[model samples]
Target: MTDFDQFEDEDDTPKSKTQIKREMEALQEIGKKLLQLSKSQQKKVPMSDTLRDALNEADRIKQHEATRRHLQYIGKVMRSEDHQAIEQRLALFDTTSAAYNKLFHQLELKRDALIGENSKEELANYLDEHPEVEDIQTLRNLIRQSQKEVSQQGKTTNRKKLFRFLRETEEKRLGLAE
Candidate 1:
């Protein structure tokens, strides 16, 4: 048959063999990332029985050679499934981490300010912004205790308690917690 006759009539353009190989390799990378997820997170990804079994087996294997081989099989299985959906779930985990880190740094800065000499005014500002926080005197005592412990070079348990309280209070305000 002639070269043009040998080509399938179904498509306007056929993908090169190298392009198909790259696509398969990209799916393999996604499968590797899926292996890094927690078991519950793994379950969130759509999976065929064969793909599920492959992932479970991969997780339980400590041997490098076996894991490498199983991972290749996972890529083959993933080819028949909706890999894009699984990738979207992974992307959500990444986005939340960046936002969580920003909030954590902000809380740390406020916690440090509360343990400093000018804490009363700083604490009042926080209270003004969060009037839902009752028992203001309890927080005052904790701050006093934290400062005293710092002066004596003692354990900063009260300081830690104040930070946790601040984080939880913020979580409640933002409706991220009950």
Candidate 2:
């Protein structure tokens, strides 16, 4: 049987010190990761008052040993709580990061297509997908400006603006409220 299976059996067997220490270390690692998260992201993590306090205290601490001790305390609190739920919530932040990366790449492709020879077809496709985008005339102007700037001055001032506009519009398409 696997080591974990032995712990699950009906027989009354005490876990070894090594197993206990390993679990504590793993929990402390999770606590450290939580501290590394941005304030807004950390706000979304479900945790008890004690655990939250410990994390806040850890943030204030600059000393190495003291911060390490606070982390251990946070791990102790974690042991008594449902860390699985905490982990699942933390995993959502990772998905958000991935989603943003994918969205940015899609916007980059749209910007490239908007400047290409088949730009009319690309613009039509974009309008079809985002009918609410009322600034078709503006996008067209920006695209023309971007091309002129690139061909003449070798600059991308209007091109960057076009990309920013595409990024914000795609954010709405992705259902990211504002």
Q: Best TM-score goes to which candidate?
A: 2
Which 10 successive residues of model 2 have the least lDDT summed? 1-10
lDDT, candidate 2, equals: 0.78
lDDT of 2 by residue, 21-58 (tens): 78888889889888988876776677888888788888
Candidate 2 lDDT for residue 111: 90
Worst 10 residues of 1 by lDDT: 1-10
TM-score of each: 0.48, 0.50
Question: What's the lDDT for residue 52 in model 1?
Answer: 82
Per-candidate RMSD, Å = 8.7, 6.8
Number of residue pairs clashing in candidate 1, backbone atoms closer than 3 angstroms, sequence gap of 3 or more or interchain: 0
Candidate 2 pairs with clashing backbones: none
Looking at model 2, residue 164 earns an lDDT score of: 87
